[model samples]
Target: MSIKSFAAKIFAGYIRKKIDNWASRPVEVQEKVFRKLIKKGRSTKFGKDHDFLNISNHKEFAEKVPVRDYEELRFYVDKMVAGEPDILWPGKPLYYAKTSGTTSGAKYIPLTRDSMPTHIEAARNAILCYIAETGNSRFVDGKMIFLQGSPEMEEKNGVKLGRLSGIVAHYVPAYLQRNRLPSWETNCIEDWESKVDAIVEETRNENMTVISGIPSWVQMYFENLKARTGKPVGELFPNFNLFIYGGVNYEPYRAKFENLIGRKVDSIELFPASEGFFAFQDKQNEKGMLLQLNSGIFYEFIKADEFFEEKPKRLTIGEVETGVNYVLIISSTAGLWAYNIGDTVQFTSLSPYRVIVSGRIKHFISAFGEHVIAKEVEEAMQEATSSTGARITEFSVAPQITPEGDELPYHEWFIEFEKEPENMDVFRDVLDKTLQEQNSYYFDLIEGKILQKLKISTMPANGFQDYMRSIGKLGGQNKLPRLSNDRKIAEQLEKIKKQ
Candidate 1:
């Protein structure tokens, strides 16, 4: 083995041992994090206003600080943005991660001096864990490409502001600096199409071994590469074997990706956000990402079904159970207290506190009392495609509450297929059956005749891409929702289909 690979193996072993030590004592580590966060929070303006000084434990803390989404917490965030000190965390934030907000125009999530390193560390440890498990540190010596946003920053009250990925780009370890692909000028291109073209040109002939990004954007890059070289990505970059991704589940895009690469590659899934780096896949054979219990964030879970109740019980790490979906609330060193990040997660393993990002709390279809989540739909799609030998490029689900003629309202699946199923009726049946098996409410609805079996509408080539482009969110950390309760997205897909 090369010198770099030999050193990587030693480092990976050390990191893996450290991770195992903490993962074994999940609740104890979390309690320590809680105490540290509370101590720091006591000094902030929000801490003072919320009576953080008097809070002694989780119960008191919960009572003192109600869970607040971005809109509810804007009062304090606005102060932080306006150059106020100690409004949320302590002192001014080091940076503000700018992201699109649903009701609020743009959210500026603070990244404090204490909290920023956790993001970088979590990402680094994920790779180390993979290397330790698989004994595959040779990828360390090869070129790596992280398709991401521009590193360009705008300042707000002395705080650097940019997309989370852009901010992270600045923190890539020194050792990997020479190995990282796409020159800085190419990454700074404002337009995603141009950026991808530049990236393709720059990295097409390089010895790329690891590529990281959201699956959709990476798919675009792969397509562009194939178009240019007339060869599958794996053939062009023989050393490429590790695929690291975050932001969205990669299962739905797996088939198309395998086809583009002409082979299967091992992948690491990450559960990260602007608020904090929460979890990363620590085991290649495991079912879920290892929850970052020792990170500088204290976690709270409200059962997703009861999330909207007047007062839902917030459970700590010690009180959670497997197979239950919960709204992930967090109080972090970043200065967010009882903050709702809007994502829902389910524990797949409690011994080491591993979790799967189940879906977004707001992104579900319950128009007919059948609460179907993103996980169920994605899994159903996976099962149907696997069974039928079909390859899908992208898809989204929405409730069709109104249907013409005598047909009952049903779920409308807008799907973009790379290889259409030979028997589409059979494909649709398998999709519907798999969803019903996973979600009992939907099963009940189907059995009671309240809703009909789901229908599929094949999207034209690049239909989803066109929709995203139209909305000005075509690339760089933006992903379409897997499902929506309302018809806003469904109606738009209809227009794209007709076109």
Candidate 2:
């Protein structure tokens, strides 16, 4: 056996043993870790202000610190960015993960020396756990290309500034670095198209076995590779067996990915965010992701209906029930205190505490009280694609509720297609029918003549790309909002189409 294979076997065993105790009593593990987090940050300004010293449990912690959105927490984050020590967490942050938050601009989130592990360790162990479960160590023996952001971190106020993916890429472990494709120079190319071209050239002949990135970028890479070399991706890299994806839902793009790959490959879903590395698909056969409980982040959940209220109810792991959409709140060692990250998640299993992302609190369409979310839209699209022989590259939806009073309001969709549906009218009907079945409010709106059926506009080629680039949010972890309550994004799409 190869030395690398031997090392992977040992590492997999160690990881499995390390995490076995965690699944047995998840609530206990989180409770114990929450106390540790409170104690660790008790000396910071945020800790003292929130009475962390007097708080020893979840109830006490929630009572003292109010749940805050990014706008409210931006005060402390601003101080940290201005080079203030102990403003939120103890000492200055090593770097800030630049991301698009609630505001129109970028939000700089802190990544402290102590809290970096919450990102790094969780990602590493996610892979290790997968290997332990599947006994697939051959992935470690070949090159794996992470189609991530540029690793060229810029300095702001004497601290590094980059996207979360770029920050993680910077710290790619030395062992994996030996098997990783695309040099740092190629990764640093700011123009995404140019970088993708460089990546295609670099990884074309490599012994690639594992690929990781957002599903859209990975698809683009595969498409380009096929263009450059007249062969299917599976034929080029016969050993490529794993595809890791996160950031956005992969359901709508799955068909396109499979077509490009020319076969079914194992894929893992991750729920990592700028706030923390939250959850990952640990067991290949499991339907839901295993939440990361002992990762220095204390989690709280509030039902989506209650989350927007003046006094929201916060629930711990012990209180969450399966199949209900709950807004996620976190108090992390990375200096966030009872921060609401605006993500909506649903628990699938309470015994081992497995969950999956439902939607974003702000990204849903409920202008007319339909209360439609990302999960609803994505699943509906998946069904539509399956039934209509179509493939979606990207799509977004908005409520057209203020249409001519004589006519009923309807849902408007702007779609960029990899392969257009054989019959567009049928595809739209399938989506509308599925959504009506899934949501009572939407059905009521349709039945009572309050709204008409869905309206889908097949966008010009690369419509989404042009829109993103025009707004300077073109690449590197930037994802298009899939659903919105207003016509702002739809109007923007029209402008992009005209241009």
Candidate whose TM-score is highest? 1
The TM-score between candidate 2 and the true structure equals 0.97
Q: What's the TM-score of each model vs. the native? A: 0.99, 0.97
Kindly list the per-residue Cα lDDT of model 2 for residues 70-188, writing each as its tens digit.
78887888888988899888899988998875565788988888788779988888888888888788888899998888887889889999888889887888988999978989988
- Per-residue error for 31 in candidate 1, Å, reads 1.0
Candidates in order have lDDT scores of 0.94, 0.87
Write one digit per residue (lDDT tens) for candidate 1, span 340-424. Answer: 9999999999888899999999999999988899999999999999999899989999998989998999999999999999999
Error of 2 at 315 (Å): 0.0
Model 2 residue 409 CA deviation (Å) reads 0.7
Error of 2 at 18 (Å): 2.0
Point to the candidate with the largest lDDT: 1
> Residue 247 CA error for candidate 1 (Å)?
1.2
